[model samples]
Target: MTGPPNSPTLLREMSERIRALGELPQTSEARAEVEAALGSKWWGLRVLAIAVIGAWRDKAWLVERALRAENGMAGGRFGHARTQSWRDLEAQTAAKAAVPMLDPADAGWLLDRWFSDEPLAFAFYEYVGLRLDPTAVERRVAEEFARRRSQQRRLPLFRLLRLRRGVADRDARLRRLAQGGDETALLARDLLSMEARFRDRQAQTPGGAKRAKVSAGAARRAAAAEALAESRRRAGRKGRR
Candidate 1:
């Protein structure tokens, strides 16, 4: 599969992409490359895909597909490979457009994914090369976590729960999960603690949340830049060979 920084097909995609500006992106070949990278076992290849989709002109189904790929395969509630939870913090931040584009039904769907036999991988970072501003689909992610506090992948889901934090029953849910006295519950407790600290810190400053968000974004860009630079260095070596 070929795309982005180099590839004739990607150039074709660029052209088709521009012409279809008012509509969904029409670069089928480019989309295919993105899909392939999203599913690749090679982490570098996945990184490239992450960069690609971040800037892809196709904003509809393609973004949806990218979200699914990044969401990581569920490891089951108790056995959650905890796909999203385990994602590199920078990479998850880099996938700026991911959270907001989720379909509302995704909470239920992801719950199901959490229980399925999906194969999980941690590759996805290169391809297109950079992510745009994030749009938080906090509601959807929060729903997934709230429906089951002990659910697998609690990290990312819990992180997005700020909007739902006002719900009166969250403390009760946390208490219930904490009582489980299992690893899953333990992990949830840790994340909840961290979330509380973050929320409190944000509350303490007028622009603290914004600055923190910027910090996460900057970190993701730095990571992507370093990875892409390494990817390019290797690509240069390969071409010379």
Candidate 2:
């Protein structure tokens, strides 16, 4: 019987099922339910099932199985036709789930994949690798920085800026990035400009302070964006990739 669009019952039932999967006795029956959910017609169900698989993998019997399953699922191109498939979300989920278990070699492999993978998952694989071990990834980025082309360097630079979580380091990192001559640098410049404008806005004396600085930054940022676009066009890319 169909319930009214996402009725309370469905939500509660789904939540209970997920919780059950996490709490179950690690029986074959529970494993079967997990597999069945993976094969469901509803994508949301499949995603939740995958997440549940991650959630409960610490149980003794499930440890290896969950690892293998997530690796397999991460490799799939599964989705219905005439609709968009989010390759990144589930990949990200699996990546996050697996971080605690990663060895140095595994983290290294992920960094290489993040750099070379055709369809990247938000550069978050880079994030995951770094989160696993910041020094290793940072070393790789520095070693590879000058060798990679502009498009190639963008994400790594962006990720570097992100990994600097300390306020002083973040500010310094932003300034350093904003001065570079790449797409990532353009983004950093825009971000710094935006932050400045936001501060000026808080003063409310914002009349002259905000206008002149914002306009100058706006024009520069716009030009930087167009230049980046033209570079892409020259490279035969119209953005969607």
Alpha-carbon lDDT, every model: 0.44, 0.55
Model 2: worst 10 consecutive residues (lDDT sum): 58-67
Candidate 1: list runs displaced more than 4 Å: 1-26, 32-42, 57-96, 113-169, 172-241
Off by over 4 Å in 2: 1-19, 58-96, 100-105, 117-130, 149-155, 162-167, 170-241
Error of 2 at 189 (Å): 11
Question: In model 1, which range of ten residues has the least summed lDDT?
Answer: 125-134
Top TM-score: which candidate number? 2
Model 1 TM-score, 2 decimals: 0.29
**Residue-wise lDDT of candidate 1 within 61-127, one digit each (tens)?**
4444544544443323323444444344324534454544544344444334333344312222221
